[model samples]
Target: MNKYATCPISTNRINERVARLNGLFTFLLIMLFIITRLWYIPAFLAFDFLMRSINLSKFSPLAYLSKGIVKLLQLKKKFINAGPKIFAARIGLLVSSAIFIFSLIGFNITAIVLASVLALFSFLETAFGFCVACEMYPYLNRFLNRLQ
Candidate 1:
């Protein structure tokens, strides 16, 4: 993490605000996605923007999309520097987002229940700083790397 990265949040360790926001966003986004609601899309979209305003989501999908849209367009200098908290948010959202899309075929009750549980976890990060996905990422990466 750069010393001068936005978010006024100093620390590779995820900050309290980032955790709470990520948790709330994940829980709500997943809940919204399950109901086949269009409202979730804008809500989700707004999340990255909010994070960006606070300097949380740095080089996320939108940033990637912008750069992809115009190769010559220079991304903001701070755009590419992803902090740990934002990274956790990115990964959690990625997983929950997939679950949301998968629920479209039908209301998979099991999936809904599982997702709700995950949402609660995001909520818990506010108090416990528990990032289940981040904790798993390393082992999963090692296992996948070994397989390859």
Candidate 2:
């Protein structure tokens, strides 16, 4: 048994503002991909993956931008469980990577569909505080466990 599984880190470690900002950033980038089908979005996606891997997403460029938006708008912090949001970020990373690969390989329709899905998820998180990836995490874990 993994000791960490029994004694996981506290979930309330990140601010809600960060998650919202992340969603907002994701939404914008995905929309850009939908419109341009270019490299910028994919490059940012790669960067996001790298930062998350290093546990430095809090210091990411969009994070700073989001913080600025919060300050500029005088938004209040609404802290919540960090675990789900982190999971959602991982999902975002995966989708973005796929979008990048598909777009690069000339699979425009597939990339567009994936980007649309990602944008929808981001919009939900940004506007409604709902995270599809977060909601799916538990079920996915259980399913994987059963399959093993």
Candidate 3:
């Protein structure tokens, strides 16, 4: 469990405070989607997650917003391995994409449930620094390795 705290899959490091802020933004966006039932909210999140997942952080609006907020708050940097956060972004992309597709096809219930779960995950990340996706990564990595 402790090993996951410093994920070694990527050598890059990122500011943990900024990552938490990004999670907060994600949580708020999902809550907004839940309240407004606007399909584009999830769609935008999916696109943003896609950008981050692909290492194009410069293109992610959430990243930019998070960075700005951190700067405004004068938060001290706390660096951590980027691997877990990158993996979490990929999971976010998949979940948001599913929410978008489900909402588009009239499966409102499914979309809402998924959105709720995603919101909870994001909340945990923001409030508790607990990343469910990061915990799942080692098992997933081992599974993928075995398939090779």
Candidate 4:
């Protein structure tokens, strides 16, 4: 039998590098949404949402950029439970999808509002290490379980 077969080097967690990179991606998308010249940006973000929601971040271009940033900054990988982040990503996906649909329908004001909220979320993650969606997951879970 192999020694330490049960010892796993990692688990269901992502490091700060990945989290920060994701925040940067969201921040940029928020800017694009606000700029108004880049109409296709939201469509691209919709695709990114699909990629992330499906757990394909490894294939995402922004992931590559974030990896580069992590290397450049020599940031340490401090892994934390991935469940919360995944929940947060789903929330982000919903918001981005809504923004995409609203923008496509020319409901610019609604799109802007949603995008701004997303921007706030991303900014909090990037600047303050706060994740609203992640924070809400436990409460939401309990609430749902109560419903059932």
Best model per TM-score: 3
Error of 1 at 145 (Å): 2.0
Q: What is the TM-score (0 to 1) of candidate 1?
A: 0.52
lDDT of 1 by residue, 5-75 (tens): 32323344423443454456555666675575444453454455455435544544453444343445533
Ranking by lDDT: 3, 2, 4, 1
Mark the regions of model 4 whose C-alpha exceeds 4 Å error after superposition: 1-10
Best-fitting candidate, scored by lDDT: 3
Q: Count clashing pairs, candidate 4.
A: 0
Which regions of candidate 3 are displaced past 4 Å? 1-8, 146-148
Candidate 1 lDDT score relative to the true structure: 0.51
RMSD of each: 10.6, 3.9, 2.1, 7.1
**lDDT (0 to 1) per candidate:** 0.51, 0.77, 0.93, 0.75
Measured against the true structure, the TM-scores of the candidates, in listed sequence, are: 0.52, 0.86, 0.92, 0.84
For model 4, give the 10-residue run with minimal summed lDDT.
1-10
Error of 3 at 39 (Å): 0.2
As a TM-score, model 3 comes out at 0.92
Per-residue lDDT of candidate 3, residues 1-148 (tens digit):
4545445478888999989999999999999999988999999999999999988998999999999999999999999988889999999999999999999999999999999999999999999999999988877877777999
lDDT for predicted candidate 3 compared with the true structure: 0.93
